[model samples]
Target: MYEPFFEMTNTPFRNDIDTDALYLSSDMSEVLSRLEYAAARQLFAVVTADVGCGKSTAIRRFTSKLSKENYEILYLSDSKLTPRWFYKGLLDQLGIESKFYRGDARRQLHQQLEIIHGIYKKHVVTIVDEAHLLAKETLEEIRFLLNTKMDSHQPMSLILVGQNELWDKLKLQHYAAIRQRIDLKCEIPQYDLSQTHEYIAAHLSYSGGAKEVFTDKAIDEIYRYSAGSARAINKLCTHALIYAAQRAKKLIDDHMIREVIAGELP
Candidate 1:
């Protein structure tokens, strides 16, 4: 409801992944470093984060910065828990046809990867999203894929991205092989207080808010309620902006902040 009163061009705290609103917090930067390290070393890297914690955003940022001349990537966002469907998704991502059978599907995938390894002296990265949904047998199948290495060269680097539960599920004793193969284990924690402030300001700056739009008191309240989580903070702050607009207020203060925090805003 708020917009014209605050002179804001758009909402600031959207939960969606917006590269323009990305705040390079220290933790996110560290995770990016891990990704780069894993890619450079050709190791099997994995990143796990809770939902709405910007894991996908981090991956998108990482992919944008890669050296195109040396990297051939196949990103698969939907890989179910069944080994057969997982194999089929990989094949489809690589444009390799399968006979609709897991055995033949896997054979085709392995042969195609081997061919790619020889023909293109570039690194192959297979990014699997929502990996936490993968069943134990499916995870074992992934481990088997990792075993298909050519000499000292690992044909493909598997990067598993999923929610926090994926890490817990992977810790089961039976999945030890898959756990052991993860060279990089990184998690995205919630944003810190300063990060929250910067995050809001960055987005607001894009949306036409002045530096003085959010006072220190208001920012502190946001951080307190959001617990430094970017997702929560965005929700609260965005609502507060709308509150100000509804009240025809030009500046956000403790009162408006409390209104949002209390769920009083429409």
Candidate 2:
């Protein structure tokens, strides 16, 4: 509804925006580098962030940049995942039917990974997202999964990505065994005020409209309410855009943002 009003060729703040077009803040850059290192060495890594803080975006970019010829990436995001299903889920990604029993499935997955590593000369990178919700038995299975070849090396790179509570959970004494295996730890911090400003500008740039369509005061209001969460910013901006279009306003000011927050946003 707002495209013509803003002279934008495409809508801004869309979730389906291309990864190449997305903004990469400084912290994101560093975290991406660490993830790259983890993938290369087949190490265990833990990535944590606040809700809607771009954890999925960073993983998307990182996986996109990986060479398919040298790497195979497997992704799973089940909150109720169990040990048997965990092995089965990864095996299913590789087009293998898992055994009904957990132990058999584990061995079968390991055999496939070893063949891929030793023969095909390709690395397998497995990412378990929303890992904060994994049960205690499943997490213990993770530590054991890494203990192959008499605790020599891991067959595949394992990355656990979750909200901040994941790391907090790992800090407890009960989870220390798995926590000790994490070779790299990265946290995606929420954007500060300036990064939030740049984030809006970058996304708006995709619209082919003036980046200043959102005023400085408007951003201040957005940052105040969103606290620099990218998802919240997108929601607020999308609503503001529609509100502005309905009212025939090309520019979004602080009052417009406030109205959107009060009337539309929770």
Candidate 3:
């Protein structure tokens, strides 16, 4: 409803937005560069951030830039993951039929990764998203995977993407093996007030809306309520636009943001 009023060619605050249109703030750029470096070196890396801080988006941007011929990237995100299922998922992504037992499946996955890295001369990058929810057994299996070839050579690069709790989980004494193998640890920072404004304006501009569609006061309210979370900002801005459209308002102002925050507007 607000698209016509705002002259937006597409919805701006959508969650599944194209990575090409993402506003790469300095912090985001640095995280992406570090992720790329981990991939290039086939190292075990951990990336953690607060919920809705755009860690997955950063991973998408990084993987999208990798050459298909040189890299095989497998992405897995399952909150209720188990060791058997984890091995099965990896085999599925590698196009290999999983073995009947978890042990056999694990060996098969390791062998396949070795072939991909040594025979095909391509680095295999496995990205496990939402890894904080992984069972202790599953995490232990991950550490065992890293132990292939007695750590002489990294068969594949493993990237764990999760919330801050994942870091705490890794710090446990029982998980020391995996913790020590993590070569790179990165955390995505929340946007500052200035970055928040630029983020909102960039999204609006990318969607063909005028940068001034959201007034400064409205942006301030959004930042105040969202705490610099990209997902929260998108939710607030989307509702504000809908509310403004319903009231036939041309500009999204602080009042509209307030209404959205107070649940006065759907």
Best by TM-score: 2
TM-score of each: 0.88, 0.97, 0.95
Q: Tell me how candidate 1 scores on lDDT.
A: 0.77
Weakest 10 consecutive residues of candidate 2 by summed lDDT: 10-19
lDDT of each: 0.77, 0.93, 0.89
TM-score of 3: 0.95
- Residue 60 of model 2 has an lDDT of 92
Please list all clashing residue pairs in model 1, or write none if there are none.
none
lDDT, model 2, position 147: 89
Better candidate by lDDT, 1 or 2: 2
Off by over 4 Å in 1: 1-11, 15-21, 264-266
Backbone clash pairs in model 3 (N, Cα, C under 3 Å; residues 3+ apart or in different chains), count: 0
Which sections of candidate 3 miss by over 4 Å?
A: none
Q: List the residue pairs that clash in candidate 3.
A: none
- Per-residue alpha-carbon lDDT of candidate 2 for residues 1-266, written as tens digits (9 for 90 to 100): 88888888878898768888889999999999999999999999999999999999999999999999999999999999999999999999999999999889989999999989999999999999999999889999988888899878889999999999999999999998998999999999999999999999999998888677889999999999999999999999999999999999888999999999999987
